[model samples]
Target: MGADRGRRGGRPVRVGVYVGCGALLLAGCASMPDSGGLSGVESTPRQDAQVRVFAKSPSKDASPAEIVQGFLEALTSDDPQYETAREYLTSSASQAWDPYRSTTVLAEGPNAEAVHSGTSEGTAEILYRLSGSKVATVDTQHAYAPDSGSYSRTVHLTRQKTTKEWRIDGLPQGVVMGRTDFQRNYKSVNKYYFASNVSSETGGQLETVADPVYVRKQVDPMTQMVRALLKGPTRWLDRVVGSSFPTGTELKKGVKSLSPDDRNMVTVPLNQKADHVGQGQCSKMAAQLLFTFKDLTPTGVDEVELQKSDGSQLCVLTEDQADGIASHGTAHYPDYQYFIDGKQRLVRMPSSGSDKQPEPVPGALGDGDKKLRAAAVSRDESSAAGVSTDGTSLYVGSLVSGGSLGEAVLHSQGKTADDRLTTPSWDGQGDLWVADRDPKNPRLLLLQKGAGSPLVVETPSLDGRIKAVRVAADGVRIALIVEKDGKSSLQIGRIERGTKSGEPPTVSILELRSVAPQLEEVTAMSWAGDSRLVVIGREQGGVQQMRYVQVDGSTPVGTAPSALTGVKEIAASEDERLPLVAHSQEDGIVRLSSGEQWQKVVKDGTAPVYPG
Candidate 1:
């Protein structure tokens, strides 16, 4: 249930994409090599097994040292068959290879030996020595069974008769180690050692070593002290201030005596506790820290903002978004509030008082009894469907699902649910134009301020498919896509207020090939200026492209398609010099500002555009 709710809020809204559950088919392995089903070296099964072990075991293990050598050699082999020395085991080894088998052997004596063993079904049992190079005894138990007897095994380094050499091979039920055991063994081996698997339960595995650098296997007292002071929360402030001071000792009355040069160290944290010592002490500490450049930055701010501060605008440094406020600081921690400067860098601390305001709530989108046919809003949330220029009213078209089209209404202030309009899209001036998608008699509905029974202009049969419909700023021209004969084409119409022209509005076909021969269909169309448009679509070769078209009822000057290939979305700026185009597969938004020089202004996931 939690996952379902998360999907609703965290998942992207799919306007044209459909998602569904799927299944993955697992193919069975090829039939085992048939050697007449013999039992030993002659049979394909038995030979394959022994061959696998031969591939893994080191060439020599004649002595105790050879056992460690053999173990290291086995680990170096990346291939599981070679790494496991599987062929060396008896036929019963098949049971040991199953993944369901998860178990470890922890034996402590003079040797303090520990071993981990587990298998991933028919695959292999991977193991490593957790601690104690020398072996004394081995204890093994199954992960699925606690009552199972502990298998006692011994290591016997012997020479290979066939190779006429010594090697650690053909040992039965040997112990090995895994990741979990590695951590356990590391701590047990070094009493002073502290290590943690940084891996998340569902993510990748990482290991952090404390007190000593475990990998290089080196120990440094001073470096370890600094690392602990920096990361340990409970003892952090005390350890840091203590080490920096010379012969400092705690005194009565909530104070500590320190050397003159190190006095500032204690003063910094004390100044922060102003209520206990008074504002005068806090100000003195802040001033001192600033002058010494210890922890306080020159901008009179802490590293991060205060907790629970309200009404903070989150940073969104994308090309289409608003710039950050000046004289403020940058925020890195989650849910933090800070003030930043014009360069988008941290500059000042956020106001830390009770006057913090609440995040503003948008006005409720009124939903009336009127039915909605279609709706579209501006990409930047700058305008909604059918909003008035003054932002006081809305143009709405109502049609009941599976019912006849209803009248277009211009809605104003109201709390009544029955008074709401449907299918709202606005022009540059807030004049909303909607469409009644009546399969039988489709119509273009218009709503303007102070208008009643909206001006409905009957439209041609758009077959059964309508892609998109939007209006120009002047509210006199509208652009839409209508499908006929299973093919879509761009259609433009004139929208006149209160005029029953008695005739269909003038329509024109936007032929991209005639305009730019390489173009195919128009997937997106936006007005570049008063009389120009920016269209995005694929070319005849199925390569996505962007073209600029001038629509003044005259021949247009066709600029070359965007030099940047694979353009999926082209957002024209108020100045055309910086058109932002998004590439879905490349997962980056590039600004075409330097004339064919594309700069990756925003990275992927800022706002992901679904690929077609």
Candidate 2:
């Protein structure tokens, strides 16, 4: 049982709930995508997008069961204001109810059963037990995290003397629905933030980090987005990313509807706390807002104007101005997708070029003098890091002509090639990361600027040895494959950095959470979008398969790539427009573009990669 919350209620007439005949009927299902492959059968939306559900107001002298059923049905309707849903509650309960505090998603529609709890003031009372298997909870921040266990909440209803109707007097905060209804009502949007400590070292350029959240698809998304942005990033990302908005900043008093004006600009009137920020900090806040609102629509908002509490314009930021303040990984589309050809040398081909012949890069790794086993290219495409064929040596050099691969920068003393160094990866900061899997001394190392002594990253909470590591483009988060007891699962860890000047920055991986707990083994994965990853793994006793999992552990619908066999390495770009590339043992390098099947890129190539 959960805590008792909210106000009293009365039983009223129901609209579409018909449980007496048999099983409960579900209405207002959302239309699904055309591709039709769902992460799970129950998770897919079934409502027609064109069909709008108009909830019916409660009727007089409704039963307790009818009132409870009607409100649950109303929660899933398309009635924008939810006026009909409120009709089921008493006047005081209706006024006190807040449906958006949070949303609890269950594996199926909640089952409400009524039992006589007691009576007060010569009126009968009934307690409705709402129960189901909990799947996830979308917090007030709109963040989603996987959950399990049974859910039970008691809703106490009392009979009214005036109407003789049984209305709920006490209920839990927030709405509760099944997975299908959640899929119909809410959508995922990326909220952006700036990377801390990086601009301090790189001269004041904020790299944007995306924090994804779920919001109602049809409601006033602009206003909801603004409110969420003001609250700050989600808890999982709070330690690593920084928001430009000052603490306690909020929408100005009496400011609710925040639609873009006729001039295509959104004027956000903020409280007194945000009124005194400097121009640079103000622009950074507006830049984060702009990036966050981009997910609302294509043309809803082009500029953001921050207003003081007194309605004075504090600052206005256009799209171009916002870009100058912060850089998303998509600022420059990559020129090529790189890989090691049959000759064990680094090579590249145009990213969008169709079946073009691969060419050796103009670098030491491509000079045919070094037989490499694995490699990584800097985000800017200016440098490359390669591991020797034996996997004991790691070499970093320039990617331009005349660039030389000097002595090996790092070495591993693992007994075998498989136990040496994992494939290296570069972050947007131009730093390199790799895990040394030596049985004698295992460590996760970071090469600052791909040079100097490598720094061993601290991971006090890691229970297993690191199998593979992929740093996110923002450098605030990392995707790690951890192996323990012969199984490997995918985990995301926040990269926290120290700020004291002169001393080497203290870097540690904190709050590690498993994003694919069901998978028995995760062989390879890459950042596919702002907070999504393309993962290659399979469940226990299951066949190998590939799918996309959100950093927060929710599986998105209709976006999984086509199935492939024997995938040794997989690569995806933060720029979601690019196709997914993978090196398959049977098919060599293959690519999967949207709405298309996997196409072969080569017959013998291996280790395909896109510049981070």
Candidate 3:
């Protein structure tokens, strides 16, 4: 929710036409073979992922600059082994350099400038500075993290006595490439895990959380993804998500590849670390695999079979069985998109593209005299939470009719509406979360099952008061609009819950980092995918914009939501198939159906929201 000002702040690759072969400066294009219903790490027409990069060996008599440039270019290629990139390096450097150590993505192609030139023991010694603005980095685990700053590295080259050719003698570990090239060579994939801190007594909804990472697009992505999953979640998410695989569990030694069998099941052979696990834990591990692969190998993958170190069956889990172990939200379809209407009544419309008159939900929020300023429906649509018009009270009630509205479950002491409570949000585990904007005692509160005493969530790292809050359906991550110094930014934080000895479990919103640092102020945001958020904000003093940002703070490669004006509140379903619902000042309660413009749903409606 924000000022009326919106402000605020693909198709699979075609086979063939792969990288061209030959000894050119940069490697020619190449393509990967489509196998087992996979489509070469699918990309849209605009993305060059369909085109493979070929690394070119340094030309004869190449200068130090040329050798460094050739080697850097090779790092961006799809070559599985990066052999060509090694040719430009001295024999010892080649063996010591590890391209997979990490990837430092820069704002643009690096600039190489001669930093030093001299002679050491009659052999020509030279050094070039490769510099650019660092945007982010992907670690060896394929996890991504934002690391904004200047990036400067020295590439030392030497003239070999025998060949009299310049070759790189020393360079920083890991590959460096521009953002465009990084996206071309890598694709984001979600590694799944169980929510570590959610309440087991609260219906025990074992849910899977998304831990996104970048993997080489043209490599054996299925295998890479499986390996990443087995390695556990990214560092930031490691504390909040639990992996079923035991520590040190990994693919068996000498097992370098994995493929789906004729029955559409991918068999994974694990080392002894996973051999002693019982049926329950092993099945959970398989569930993690099936969840990660469902979207990856969409067409053929139906099961995940785990084999022990000696090739004996440990456990096998089919997609159907995994669904029983954890709720991934893939099967839950949102029933309706909801909002507060003209009379301040919580109202709803079918999620499908229907423009008929809206109806009030079957609850106190819908029919009671109490006026609500905003509301959040549960993902299952069985319950709803509403914030009073004055933003002082929060109420959670079932969607069923005839239920009486209980006293305010939460309240804020702020005297003004703007200083009171922002919109409240519901997570898949049936818990409700809201932030009180009280100037004297700002706090983020959580209520289990929407009742009982409100628990103050620990947010040790939060810099400013939270103006808005939305929890992902997975119950592991949260999107927050933080207001500070007259500007608001979108931050993605890890939601952690832990139970200490003889005490109730505690919850904390940890590591609140802005995902939309480019936006001067973020007006609204919603979880668009497992690790992506659709945010509405604008560059400092610029027109407001809407775009998708990875939880790791990287802009996604895709078309932004179509332009709209005066978006006060926005609602989106995890099911990308649903139309986007927004409360536009220009056209109240509008819907952006797939491939269609925003259509007015109701006049002057406010606070549109889909279930979390």
Q: Which regions in candidate 2 have their CA more than 4 angstroms from the true location?
A: 1-54, 78-83, 91-97, 115-121, 200-203, 499-503
Number of backbone collisions per candidate, in order? 24, 14, 14
TM-score of 2: 0.89
lDDT of 1 at 438: 39
On residues 1-612, what C-alpha lDDT tens digit does candidate 2 reach at each position?
111111112322224421111112233222433353222121223544344544455668887777777677778766666777877778888788888788898877777777556777777888888888898899888999888899888887888888787787788888888787778777788888888745432646678988888987656667888899899989888877788899999999898688777788888999999989998888888888888877667554689999988899889899888877777756647888999988999999888847788899997889889998888988889999999999899999999988888999899999999889988999888889999999899999999999999998999989998888899888889999999999999999999877587888777899899998889899999988888999999898999999999998888756579889999999998888898899999999888888899989888888888886
In order, the Cα lDDT scores of the candidates are 0.30, 0.81, 0.80
Per-residue alpha-carbon lDDT of candidate 3 for residues 1-612, written as tens digits (9 for 90 to 100): 000100000011121112533333233323534344422222212334344545556678977655765676667667788888888889999899988898888776676778789999888899888777888888988888788899888888889999999898898898888776777778887888998877542554578888888888877788899888888888888887889999999899998888787798899999999889999999999998988987565463798889999999999888888888888756657878888999999998888877668899997989958899999887779888899999999888889988778888888999899999889888888889999999999999999888899889999999988989999988888999998999998988889887789987699888888787889889988877777888998898799888889898887766889999888778887777788888888889888977778787888689999886
Task: Give TM per candidate.
Answer: 0.28, 0.89, 0.90
Better structure of 1 and 3 per TM-score? 3
lDDT of 1 by residue, 1-612 (tens): 000000111222111101111122112223444344222121012111112111134334243333333342232222323334443333344244431122233222112122433334432232322232221121221101111123333332333345444333333343433222222221111001111111111222111111111110012222222222223212111221112111221122332221112222222111121223333332322222222221111222222111111223211122111111110011111121111112221111112212232121121211322222223333223222333322224433221123222332444342332222323445433344554433443455554421455556445433434445555443344566554464445555544333236953332212211222234466655555433456666665576566665332221333544566555444432223334444333644444443455655434311111100
Q: For model 2, how many clashes?
A: 14
**What lDDT is obtained when candidate 2 is compared to the true structure?**
0.81
- The predictions' CA RMSDs to the true structure, in order, are 28.7, 6.7, 7.3
Report model 1's TM-score to 2 decimal places: 0.28
